[model samples]
Target: MTKIKICGITRLSDALESCRAGADALGFNFSSLSPRAITPERAKEIIEKLPPFVASTGIFVDQSPEEINAICRFCKLQIAQLHSEQYSPEDARAITEAKVIKVFRPEENFAVEEVFAFAEKSGINAFLFDAYRPDMAGGTGETIRASLATRIFNALGDSCYPILAGGLNESNIGEAIRSLQPYGVDTASGVECEPGIKDPVKIKAFIQAVRKTVF
Candidate 1:
C-alpha cells in the first residue's frame, strides 16, 4: 500500500485531524525557512496526543547533526527527514535515535546516479523525491515527472522505500501513485487552505483517494 503523509502541520488540530483521517505519517517542519515551521516543544505537544503506529517526522534542513538529533530526542520523533543537500551521509548516520529519511530534490538536470550516490549514505531508512526549486528546499508545490520518479524507483529497486512529494492533492494523487508506485506520498500545500493551515475536507478527500488507489 502507498502510505500517506500529511506535511506542513502547524496546529494540534491539523495533526490530529490528519491522523484521524488516516495519514500513516505526519511531518513537522523544523526548518526556519519553512512557513509551516514548528518548534520542538510545539511538535511534542501534538505528538504526545497521537495514537501509536503513526510516525511523527521532524523535517530538518542544513542543521548540524547534533542539533537535529537533539531536537528528535526532545520531540520523541519516530523519523528524521533530512532536507538539505548540504547534509552529508556522515551527518545522517550520526543521528542516534529516530530512523533517517534523506530527501532528494531533483531538477530537470537531475540524474539517477545522484539518487544512487545519496542512497550510499549509511543509516538512511528511505528516500523521498521532491521537486527542486532554486530558491527553496521543498514544499514549493511543484512536482517532478513521474517518469523521473519511476526511474529512480527502478534504480533503487526496493533497497529502500521511495517516497514521492510535491504538488500532490486528491485530484492528481491517484495518477501520481499509479505512475511512481512509491512506498509513500507526502502533501503539504496540496491539502491546505493556505500554507500552515489544513482544510479538513481536503484532508479527508486526500486520504480517501489514497485508500482507493492500488499499485
Candidate 2:
C-alpha cells in the first residue's frame, strides 16, 4: 500500500490530528525561510506528545549537517528530508545512521540518469521529486506530470524509492497514485488552511482520498 505523509506540520493539535488520521509519517519544517518552520524545542514538544510507531521527520534546506543532526537528536526525529541543492555525498555519509530522503528539483531538461547516479552515490533512502519553483523550495502547490515522475522511477529501478510530491490534494491524489504508484505521497499547502496551520477536515478528506486509491 502507498504510505501517507502530511508535511509542514506546525501545531501540536495538527500533528496529533495527522496521527489520528492514520498518517505513516509527519514532517516538521525546520527550514528558516519557510513560513511553516518550527524550532527544535517546539518540534520536541510536539514529538514528545506523539505515541509510538509514528515517524517524525525534520525538513532541512541548505543547512549544515551538524545543525541538522543536532536538531534531529533534540527533537527525536527518525528521518531527515534534505531539500537543498548543496547536499553532498560527504554530508550523506556523515549522517549514515539517519534515514535521508533527498529532494530533487525537476528541470526543464531534467536528466534522470544524473539524478539516479547522485542518489546511488549519496546513499539516500528515498528520492522526492518536486516541481522547480524559484521563490520556494517546496509547498508551491504546483502539480507536475505524474507520468514524468513514473518514467524516472522506472529508470531508477527498485533500489531508489520514489516519492511523488508537489501540489497533491484530495481531488487529484487518486489520479496521481494510480499513475505513479509511488512509495509515498507528500503534501503541505494542499491540506492546509493557511501556511503553517492544517485544516482537520481537509486532512481527513485527503487521507480518505489516498486510502481509496491504495486500498
Candidate 3:
C-alpha cells in the first residue's frame, strides 16, 4: 500500500481530520519562508492531540543540525524532512531526534547517482521527491516528470523509500501511483482550500483515491 501523507497542516482540526481520513503522516512546515509555515508551539499543540500510530513530520529549510534536533525534541516529531541543498549528508547524520527524510527536487536532467550517494553516505533510507522550482522549496504544486521519476525509482530500487509529491490530487494520484509505484505519496496544496488550510472533502477524496490505487 502507498502510505499517504497530508502536509502543510496548521490547525489541530486539520490534523485530526487528516488522521480520520486515513493519512499515515502529517507534515508541519516550520520554514518561515513558506506561506504554510507553523510555529513550533503551534505544531506541538496539534501534534500532542493526535492519536497513536500517526507520524508527525516537520518540514525544515536550511536549519543547522542542532536547530533541527532542538525543534524535533521540543515538538516530539517522528520524522524530519530536510528541504535545503546546503545540507550535506553529514548534516543528516547529525540529526538524532528523528528519522531524516531528505527532500530532492529533481530536474529534467537530474543525476540519480547524486541521490544514491546522499542516501548511502548519510545512511538515510527515506526520501521525498518534489518538483524543481528555482524560487521555491517545495509546495509549488508542479508535477515532476514521470519519465524522470521512473528512472529514479529504477535506480534506487530497494535501497531507499521514495515518497512522491508535487501536484498530487484525487484525479491523477491513481495514474501517478500506477506509473511510479512509490512507497508513499505526499500532498499539501492538492488537498487544500489554500495554504495552511485543508478542505475536508478534498482530503477524504484524495486519501480514498490513494487507497483504491494499486501499484
State which candidate has the highest TM-score: 3
The local distance difference test score of each candidate is 0.88, 0.86, 0.94
TM-score of each: 0.96, 0.95, 0.98
Position 44, candidate 2: lDDT: 93
lDDT of 2 by residue, 6-66 (tens): 9999999999999999899999999889999998899999999997888998899978898
**Model 1 CA RMSD to the hidden true structure, in angstroms:** 1.2
Order the candidates by lDDT, highest first — what do you get?
3, 1, 2
* TM-score of candidate 2 relative to the true fold: 0.95
TM-score comparison, 1 vs 3, better candidate: 3
lDDT of 3 at 3: 97
Candidate 2 runs further than 4 Å off: none
The number of clashing residue pairs in each candidate reads 0, 0, 0
Q: Residue-wise lDDT of candidate 1 within 35-56, one digit each (tens)?
A: 9989999999999999898999
Residue 200, candidate 2: alpha-carbon lDDT: 97
Off by over 4 Å in 3: none
TM-score: model 1 vs. ground truth = 0.96
